[model samples]
Target: MNKRIFLSAPHMGGNELNYIQEAFDANYIAPVGRNIDEFEKQIKEYTGAKYALAVSSGTAAIHLALRVLGIKDGDEVMASTFTFIGSVAPILYERCTPFFIDSDTASWNLDPNLLEEELSQRAATGKKQPKALIVTHLYGQCADIVRIQNICEHYGVHLIEDAAESLGATLNAQHTGTFGKLGIYSFNGNKIITTSGGGMLVSDDEALLSYARHLSTQARDDAPHYEHNEYGYNYRMSNITAGIGRGQMEVLSERIKRRREIFNLYQKELNIIEGLSFMPELPSSVGNRWLTTILLPVHLSPEKIRVTLEKENIESRPLWKPMHAQPLFRDAKGCINGTSDTFFKKGICLPSSSSMNNDDIQRILSLLKPLLNC
Candidate 1:
């Protein structure tokens, strides 16, 4: 069998083990350690946020963000429909109602026009607007965040960016996760940079992050005795994983660059093929290009291509199914215009790991090109 081609495998920097060894030498195996502190520091420095909290996973970060924003108990929270479940799962955890917004052809992220219209309609009717909007930078690409942020501000809605797939992505000159009230980034095994598993919540508000830090550590009161004024999750990131993150941070820019190169290679190779087009980055933005996605022709299905690649031990996947289309969200409210649903049906994510080489891409194209042509 041919070697396996993963969608987005972890590509480690050379210094990961050195940091891990330092953590071990310090005997800081617990959550509260130098590694965790340094990891959070690195995130803040990189993302230009005033504060950051390293947590167990991206979902935990989102949950803490919602809690800090005081959005709960049936409060309406708006979100981008064309994203992974982790991006919006915390809304349910907080018992907040989610009103999903569809993507647009311009950025393949949330549609700002739809958002403006919805918020305007709500205001006109004297209807209660959503308390927050969780917008994802889909596939490491920038959402139209600046416009979205402006709209959210106009409507008195908090914007929480889901930059899990876009650690190094930028819109104009600003990083993605920093555009909103609170943003979260994932360092899962398959991300551009991996800490095995971890996440970071960033914000300009120091008090909010400090409160989230308390909540992440179980919301224990700072007393001599183990006392709790309120409940919170044990969502702290470990020193070991943070050690990995510290090293990952060292090479994040390089990883993003290589990923973009791979994306360019895919575009150069596949553009000539009829009815297939690569995902676009806005003229004013630069994406990490985490996974080079393509929208196939109407005659070709993403699933069929995914299955065919699986036969050759090459990994591929369909685009995210719109949240409103999920059975779990059948009763949820949404301002849908079929954009996300269409992308979901026709899009496929190709293997675009930073570790890939020209030969590896050729292997994929060798199989993929034939399928598309046929």
Candidate 2:
């Protein structure tokens, strides 16, 4: 059998070892260390956000963001149903209900139309405005932020951009994660860039960052001795992982470039396929192209193509299972128009790691072209 081709996987930069060595040499093995500080600084600088906090995972960042938004039991938060479960699970952590909205086919993110409809319906019931609105930049393509932000503002809901897969993506020159009140980034192993495992919470408001830092560090109060004024969580990223992030950050731009190149290769090679289409990045959206996704036509289901690719020793996966479709969220309220559901049935994520050489890409194209022909 040929070497097993994978979906997106960690592509490391050589400089990561230096940061790890520095952390070991300085004995900064804990979460509170120089590496963490540097990583936060890098995020703030890159995103132009006033402040940032390094956290254990993207879900933790969203939980922290939801807490900062003051969501409580029974309060409602609006989110995209067509996102990774991690994006909406944090709302459940706060004991808040997630009012899911369907995705817009153009960007494969949240549909503003569905969002407006839900907001209007919720308001007509005379309830308090939603505690927050969580919009995701799914697959690194920036959502329609301008309209989403306008809607959130009109409705007085805090906007949390779950940009886990879109660290470098932009919308009309503005960064994806920076459009909302708070934004989160993930550095999971399969993400465009990886810190081995880490995430960030960023915002223009310094106080939010301060509070997030406090909450992440066990909410210990100011005292020389062990003390706490409120409950806390051990969600801060470790110095070692931050070291990996620092190294990964150094080559983030290069990784994005490579991922985009991979997308172009697929697009060029697979352009002739009648029933297949690559998800497009709109004019105003600058997708990091995190994972190259293709949507099979009605007759050619994504799963069918996935199995075909797998049999050829190449791996592919369906798009994220919309959160509302999951059993855990079966009871959650959602405004659906079959957009996300259709995407799920048709979309497949192809191999998009930056480490793929030209030969690897050719092999993927080779396997896919014949399958499309069949």
Candidate 3:
């Protein structure tokens, strides 16, 4: 049997150990240290965000975003129905009502037209507008962000970008996360870059970022003695973890390059199949290609493909199930366009770890092509 091929394994750069060692030597084992500062700095500079706050996980960042934005219980928060659970879990944490929005065939992301319609209809009917919209950049591809941002502004809704899968993605040469009021990036084990498990919250608003920083660290009031005026979460990212992030940030461009290369390779190999389509990128946008996802024909079940890959000691998986279809969200209000539902059934996320080589890709195509009847 061959070595196990993973579905987006972490690929570490060589400088990680050096940064970790430096942190250790300074005895900065806690969450506060140079590493965290540097990590946040790099993220802010790279994404063109004015400020950034490192937290325990991407979910924590989203929660903090909600807290800082003053979105509380019973507030309606709109979200992409086609995203991973982490993107919407924060809405639940805040005891807010979630309104799911379906994806579009063009970008496989939150539909801007639907969003505009919902907002306009609500306005005409004198219904309360949702406080915010949490739109996920699915599989690292940029959503129609500029148009979405315009819609959100016109509707007086806050935009919280769930860029967890799209750290390096950009639209019209502008980073995806910077377009929204708040944006988050994940450093989970399987992300394009990893610090084992961490997340960063970014925003152009300094006050919001500062308040988020305060809330992230248990909302402690500034004083020499231990003090707290309001409730908060212990969401700080450890210095040790930040060291890994600093190193990873250094290699992010390279990682995105490799991931895109891998995607192109898959496209070249798999486009020969009669009934397959790769995830599309919107014009004027460059996605990180965090994972190479494809839609399979009705005859080629994603489950069957995943199982066959697993049998070969290779890893693969299906795309996210629409949040509206989930049992928890069964009663939630949504623009039910059936696009995301269709994608959920037919999509497969192929192994796209930057560590994977051309040979690994060919091996995958060899197994997949037969099942696809190419």
Candidate 4:
């Protein structure tokens, strides 16, 4: 059998071990170490954020962001319905009511029009409006952030950009994560870059981030002995993982370039297939192209293609099922237009690892051409 192809997997740069060794040599093995501080600095410099906090996971960052934003029990929070649960789980953690916004066809992200409508309707009805809007940049593509930000500002709601899949994505020369009040990035093993498992929270508000840092480290107050005045969480990223992140940052641009190249190859090879279409990339936005996704014909099953790929030691996956469709979130209020539902039914994520070479791409294409009848 050939090497197993992945949907998306970590491609390490050569410097990861050096940073790890430095951490070990310095004996900074805990979460609070030079590596963590350096990792945060690197992220802030890359994202143009005034502050950055290294956290245990992207989900932890979201939860901390919500807490910092004053989200509480029964407060309304809006999120993209088509994203991974990590984007919405934090709202639930705060015991907030989640209102899901449908996806826009162009970006496969939160629809700004629906958001405006939801906010307007809520305001008109004299009901409590959402306290925060969590917008996800799905599949490494920036959402229509300019318009969404305008809407959030008009409604007096905070915007939290979930850029876990869009670390290198930019729109109109602005980074996706920087467009919102607070943003997050993930460095999970399968992301474009990996720190084994870690995440970062970024913002222009230093005070807010300082509070987040305090809360993330068990909310210990300034004292000589162990003390805490508020509930807190152990969500800080460990020095070892932050060391990996520091090294990954060194080659982030190269990784983004390679991933985009992979997307281009897949687009060139597969776009000609009948009954298949690649995800649309907006002209003004440069996506990291985390996974090259395609829409299959209604008659075809993404599961069948996924199974076929699996038989050949390749990994493929169906697109995210909308939160509204999930049994767990079935009761959540959503402005439904069936866009996410349609996407879930027909969308397929192809092998898009940055480590893949042309030969690997050709092999996958050869197998897919017949199945798709291109």
Rank the candidate models, highest lDDT first.
3, 1, 4, 2
Q: What lDDT is obtained when candidate 2 is compared to the true structure?
A: 0.88
Off by over 4 Å in 3: none
Residue by residue across 237-352, what tens digits does model 1's lDDT show? 99999999999999999999999999998888889988888888888999999889999988998988999989999999999999999998999999999998999999999999
Weakest ten-residue segment in model 1 by summed lDDT:
365-374
Clashing pairs for model 1 are none
- TM-score, candidate number 4: 0.98
Tens-digit per-residue lDDT, 153-211, candidate 4: 99899999999999989989888789889999999899989898999999999899999
Q: All candidates' TM-scores?
A: 0.99, 0.97, 0.99, 0.98
In terms of lDDT, the poorest run of 10 residues in model 2 is 365-374
lDDT of 2 by residue, 77-194 (tens): 8898989988988888888888888988788888888888777877999866777889999899989899999999999989999999999999888888899999999998889888
lDDT of 1: 0.93
> Which residue pairs in model 3 clash with each other?
none
Candidate models: Cα lDDT each: 0.93, 0.88, 0.95, 0.91
Q: RMSD of model 4, in Å? A: 0.9
TM-score-sorted candidate list, best first:
3, 1, 4, 2
Give the residue spans of candidate 4 off by over 4 A: none
Off by over 4 Å in 1: none
lDDT of 3 by residue, 72-183 (tens): 9999999999999999988999999999999998899999999999999999999999999999999999999999999999999999999999998999999988999999
